[model samples]
Target: MRLNQYIAHHTKYSRREADKLIESGRVNIEKTKATLQSVLQEGASVFIDGKRIVPKEQFTCIVYHKQKGELVSKSDERGRRVIYDSLESRFKHFVYVGRLDFASEGLLILTDSTPVAKALMESHLERTYLIKIDGEVTKEMINAMEEGLVSEDARVGGHSKSEIVAMEFAAFAYYEILKNDKKYSKLKVSITEGKNRELRRFFGVFGREVLDLRRIAYGFVNLNALPCGKKRYFTKEEYKSLHTFLKEHSTKESKKIESRH
Candidate 1:
């Protein structure tokens, strides 16, 4: 494991924070100051703030962009294109953190840790999307989104209540109109929940047609500089940020749930 990952996995500090501590000369391996590229090898002693950082299970994380129409299944029944086809054969055991429907595209996380995925999904980890929809995206529409929407289909999700069952309405952390050509406009929306085809249905409430949709960010990890159909291992900083976000979100969620009762 890398030094930063080691600190993050075994300690509450995130990978980015570990990097700062290391650069500030607070971390040491065998009494030598550690660098970002420093590796934690067997029988090596690592100390941060005069305390030892015990090594934990080394985890591997990958961020991949799912190309549209590339099915997310392990294997297609009829042999259609799938996301795994683009990944290295060695990563066959890894499971995707979340599902992106066949028609949807953008940042996807592949990892062997089920606990990590569960923690994130149960929390309010934010997902950001860049979507291009037909027709003008007006201020009124944005205001409606922020207030939330009641989907026509309750089986999927909505906020309406009548017979004692109430569903969550899709809400946004922020919405930005990136481009507006009148006929077609590009938008950036950040959402906290992963409702099934929520964006499509959310826009449908306004009678808009979604042309293109892509996830640009998840939590603190950004899908930058990576092309479609390619995968890369998480750097120490990214790994740390992922863990930090999960921990903070999990704590906040548990508190919210407890307060409700």
Candidate 2:
């Protein structure tokens, strides 16, 4: 693994923070100061500021209702608000699975297990969202998205496929509605892929502007009854379900890597 990734996996700091530490000469490999470009071979001992680094003992997963204006990163160079500030102090080395933009807020999964984070974030795991758009959605646009439309911007690397899990049209005064006027319409859209600003861009193609976006679910996890800007610990069963999924996926990936070797 890369030096920064190794340090991030072993420390409470995020990957970006780990890179900063390496650049500042705070990280060491085998008692020698190391840089971000350094590589960590298998079974190599690492240290941070003279303290031996160790793997986390217990893993924790949390469901946080991220509020708008809070950056999802662990540390922002610009001194912006971050999600870590609201996390419980008892957690030693937790990292977020995915990110929500500063203007967006909803369910975000945080975990101490790097492997679990990697599996959920880097894989094809599905995520669901409820979005409020600025105008009435046309049936043609809905059909096009369901049939997998080719995005003109191509911000998402792979082909885009969106299925409207549920659709509801109501007055513009819902609590979740960020915009309310006689000219605008509200929609709750759900998609599997969690691409960057995907919901907004998807609606943008149809000339609709997304006023507000909120994630409601991720895989088997849901944000039911969880108020905005608060967090709750995952139940034992929820943890077990995630753990098993991660273990199975990791094992398959490891075998694939071995075969390539």
Candidate 3:
């Protein structure tokens, strides 16, 4: 395997991220510096940033149920509570699959194989969330979200010249009315894409403010009632289910989209 591939396969960084390490001269092949196109010498030593790393096991993949207010990061300059802080010390080397914002809570995948993480982040995967927001969630609001919304808001990654809704449409996969208090209501939504802060912005178009957001599932993996601020390795059955979801996602998305509400 190429040096970049070797690093990505062995560590948490992706192939693209591995290339950056090589470019910065932090990677070596048998004490000799390695470049992007360099391949392994059958069996040789490899060091990253002067730390020799022998190929370990298959790789570690963990699912964490994050709590609100815990940042999904290693360390924040703001010194706020972070997800890894509450996790086992061993997870210091792993990177999270995606992120749940500071105010968001629920499922997150952490792993040492970027390839696996990248596959899960692909557009075909589904992410489910339960959101509590101000005011009643009316049919019109749901329909607008399902049909998609329009805005020239570049802040949401929309092209200023294009219909904002055309950039990406987040559909509600499933939802339930948990509350209808005149001041607040709760509902769940599932979307395919992981655009930056997309959900909060999408709902903002209809004058809804998401007060609390908790992700419950991602494709085949679910929080499964796991306690908050805890992490664990996936089970054999869970791994198989996630792998199956990745394999079938392309075909599944089409059907899922057509049948979505």
Candidate 4:
């Protein structure tokens, strides 16, 4: 891994922050100034600001039931409450696996290992959600959910300030209509991709507003009976499953690298 990645995986600083530290002449490898492109050597000592870094052999992972109004960030400049405010200080340095928008709530995974977080985020794991929409479930929506949709302008249901315009929505992995009525409609949906405001944008295309959205599960992790704004450690089975997943992911990544070479 690069110097910044090595620092981020072993320390509380993010990759960007690690880059800044290296540029400022703070990071060192065996007393030699570390550069941005420096690759970590196995069994080599690393230091930042004169303090030696000892990488942990084991990493911890946790799941949090994020509330509807909380932002998945360290700090918001606008004074809005963030997930860290509700989460314990001990987890302040953990990296989140994926994001849930301010209006959306549900199971969120955080881990001390940046590698684990990045691997899970990049994988095509299914995320299941229970969503309620403001209008009836139309045939157009059903067809789109079944066959996928491409939008030239996909800014409708996204953040008002988001610059992303064009988006292609993959066909939902699975969907089941739970309730359909004139007042509102509810559905259970599963998708493999975690695109930006994807569910909202998909519904927005059909002129339907998502009134409520909550993720119930991600891969092997599930919210179960966890209350809002609370957190819990991974179960024994969950840990086992995570270990298997990480192993397979590492193998696949290595294969990709070898193919490239």
Clashes of each: 1, 0, 0, 0
Error of 4 at 190 (Å): 0.7
TM-scores of the models, in the order given: 0.68, 0.66, 0.70, 0.83
Q: Which is better, 2 or 4, measured by TM-score? A: 4
Give all candidates' CA lDDT scores.
Answer: 0.77, 0.71, 0.75, 0.91
The true-versus-predicted C-alpha distance at residue 208 of model 1, in Å, is 1.2
Shift in Å, residue 56, candidate 2: 5.8
Candidate order by lDDT, highest to lowest? 4, 1, 3, 2
Q: Give residue 251's error in model 4 in angstroms.
A: 0.8
lDDT by residue (54-128, candidate 4, tens digit) is 886698999999998899998999999899998888999998999999999999999988778998999989999
**Candidate 2, overall lDDT?**
0.71
Clashes of 4: 0
What ranges in model 3 sit over 4 Å off? 1-57, 154-167, 175-181, 245-261
| Model 4 spans > 4 angstroms off | 1-55
Give the Cα RMSD of candidate 3. Answer: 7.7
List candidate 2 stretches off by more than 4 Å. Answer: 1-57, 154-182, 258-261
Q: Among these predicted structures, which one has the highest TM-score?
A: 4
Name model 1 segments beyond 4 Å from true: 1-56, 154-168, 249-261
By lDDT, is 2 or 4 better?
Answer: 4
Model 1 per-residue lDDT tens digits across residues 204-223? 66778778889988887788
